[model samples]
Target: MAPQIVGLAFGHFALRMNPILLLGALTGAQTVTAAMAAIQERSGSPVAVLGYTPAYPIANILLTTWGTIVVAVIAS
Candidate 1:
């Protein structure tokens, strides 16, 4: 819900920019591959993947590290 709200807000703001790329980044940040595929299908372009690539890996690493830290702290 929260990410969707943010995505919608960004989507509105991204109107003047590259909507495809912004959607890509948003989906990537949330790790939603289905959304990325839908966006590609709707836009008939794979340009959004450019934004997804970087955000996905970074988010994955950060979330994993943070989750591990939280678990360790709680366990200890």
Candidate 2:
């Protein structure tokens, strides 16, 4: 929650990104599909998905790779 709040603020104020799209991207990075869905539904626009799509796959790949590294480290 804290990270999400900070990210939203940073994206909105510092980066000057659209709040709705930033929220979508944040949700995507976190792999929170439900939040993304709610955002789209509330905004009545699929535009947020533009932010989500790229972030989602990248985040998934990075997280999976990191998890594998962590497991290898633990096993070693």
Which one wins on lDDT?
A: 2
Please report, in order, the local distance difference test score of every candidate based on alpha carbons: 0.86, 0.92
Off by over 4 Å in 1: 10-16
Clashes of 2: 0
Clashing pairs in 1: none
Question: So what's the TM-score on candidate 1?
Answer: 0.79
Please give each candidate's TM-score.
0.79, 0.90
Model 2 worst lDDT window (10 residues): 18-27
- Per residue, candidate 1 scores C-alpha lDDT tens digits across 1-76 of 8876777686767655477888888889888899999999999999989978998999899899999999999999
**Angstrom error at residue 51, model 1:** 1.2
For every model shown, the clashing-pair count is 0, 0
Error of 2 at 19 (Å): 0.8
